[model samples]
Target: MKVQNKIVVVTGGGSGLGRELVLALLSSGASVAAMDINAAGLEETVALAGMNRGNLATYALNITDRAAVEALPEQVIARFGAVDGIINNAGVIQPFVRLKDLDYAAIDRVMNVNLFGTLYMTKAFLPHLLARPEAHITNISSMGGFLPVPGQTIYGASKAAVKLLTEGLSSELLGTNVRVTVVLPGAMGTNIAVNSGVMDTLEVKGGEAPVKMLAPDKAARIIIDGIENNRFRVLVGADARLMDAVYRLNPQRAARFIYDQMKALLPQ
Candidate 1:
C-alpha cells in the first residue's frame, strides 16, 4: 500500500503512537482522517502535521460509539471519495491490577475502548475498503496480547482478543482485495499511561522503568512498512519478538516468566 495519495483513517489519532502514525502517513502523501475522542488532541495533531487542506482531516468521535463509527465511512467517502485503509489504533491501558482487585467499571472501559473499538472501526470501514484494489486494515495489539500479564489481566485479555481477531480476519479475508495485519508492540516511549488515565496507578516491576521501550516514531515507521508490504504480523521491538518466541516455544513457561518478572508491579 504505497500510501501516496491514498485515504487512511487512524483511530486515537490525537496522541501517542496514533499521532505519530498519522504524521508519518501524511508525510507519505496519504490523505488522512485522524479520528479520536479527544478533540483538542486531534487539533494538535493536525497542527503538527501541517498538511494542506484536503490532505488531512480530523474526526472527534468515540470509537465505542457504534452509530458514529458506522457513519464514518460516508463522511470519509464524501471527503476522500473512497476509504483505502484503516488503522484501529485507539486503545487504553489501566494500572496493573489483578482481576479480582480490579473495578468492574475499569474492566469494561478497557474492553470497550480496546476490543470493541477495534471491532466497530473494522466493521464500519470494511465495505468501503473492499471497494478498493489493495485495501489494508492494521490492528495494533500488544506484547500483553501474546503473553499473559498477571496484574494487568484485563488489558491482556483485550489485546489477546485483538490478536486472534486480526488473525481470524486475515484468514477470512484471504481471497479478498482487503488485507488484515496485526501489530504487537512492546513498551514504547509514548503517553499511553497518561492518556489512558492510569499514570498515577502504574507501577514498575524489577525496580526499573521496563526494557525494550522503543520510541513512538520508530514504531510508527515499522507499522507503515508492514501495511505497505501487507505483512501478517509485525512485532515492534526485540522484546516483543523474544517474548513471542518464548511463548510459542513453551506457553506455560513463558507465562511463568512473565509472572515472575512482573511480580513487583502486582498489588500487595
Candidate 2:
C-alpha cells in the first residue's frame, strides 16, 4: 500500500516501536492517528512528530477495551474520512517464569493485552477495511512466536497465537483488497520490558543481551517497507530471521536450542 498521505492508526503509539513508527510514518507523508493507553506517551510522541499538525493526531485508548476499539474506526473516519491501514502493536510481556510457576493474574494480563487486544482491534476495524479499495493490517508478533523460550511460556503462547491468527486472516482475506502482515521482531532497544512491568524482575538485564537488538528507528524502517510491499510475514532483525529459519528446519530442535540459549542467559 502507498503510505504517502494515507491515514494510519497505530495502537501502542505512545512509546517504543509504536512511537518510532508514528514518527517514521509522519516523515513519509502519511497521516497518522497515534493510539495508546498511555496518554502521556502519546503526548510525547506528538511532541516528537514536530510541526506536522496537519498529519498527526493522538488518541488515548485501551485496545483491550472492546467497545472503545469498536468505536475507533468511526472516530478515524470522522476525522480523516477513511483509514488505509492499522498497526496492531499494543502488547505486554509477563515477568519471566515457567507456566507452572506463573500466577493466574499474570497469565491473564499477558493474554488480555497481547492476544485478545489484537483480536478486538482486528474485529473492530475489519469491516471498515473491507470498505476500502485496498487496506493493510500489521500485527506485531514476536520471535517467541516461532521459538518458545523457557521463562516466557505465556508470552510465547500469546505471540504464537498472533502469528497463526494473522496467517489465517491472510488466507481468509484472499480475493479481497485487504492484506494481513504479521511481524516477528527480535529484541530491540525499547521500553517494552520496562513498560510491561517485566524489567524489574528480568533474570537477565543489560550488556550484550543474547539477541542482537536494533534501534526502534531501524525496526520501524523495516516494518514500513513490509507494509508498503504487502509482505505476508516480516521478520525484523538478523536474530529473528535466523531463528525463523531454525524453526522451519526443525521445530523440536529449535525449541530445545532456544531453551539452552535461555539457560545460558540466566545469572549464575
Candidate 2: worst 10 consecutive residues by lDDT? 203-212
Q: What is the lDDT of residue 234 in candidate 2?
A: 96
Clashes of 1: 0
- What TM-score do all the candidates reach, one by one? 0.96, 0.95
Q: Residue 20 in candidate 1 has what lDDT? A: 93
* Predicted candidate 2 versus true structure: per-residue lDDT over 81-142, tens digit per residue: 99989999989988776677779999999999999999998998899898998999999999
User: Lowest lDDT 10-mer window, candidate 1?
Assistant: 203-212
**Model 2 accuracy (lDDT, Cα):** 0.89
Question: Cα-based RMSD of the predictions, in order?
Answer: 1.5, 1.6
For model 1, residues 70-156, the per-residue Cα lDDT tens digits are 999999899889999999999999777788888999999999999999999999999889889889999999999988888788998
Cα displacement (angstroms), candidate 2, residue 82, comes to 0.8
Off by over 4 Å in 2: 205-208, 264-268
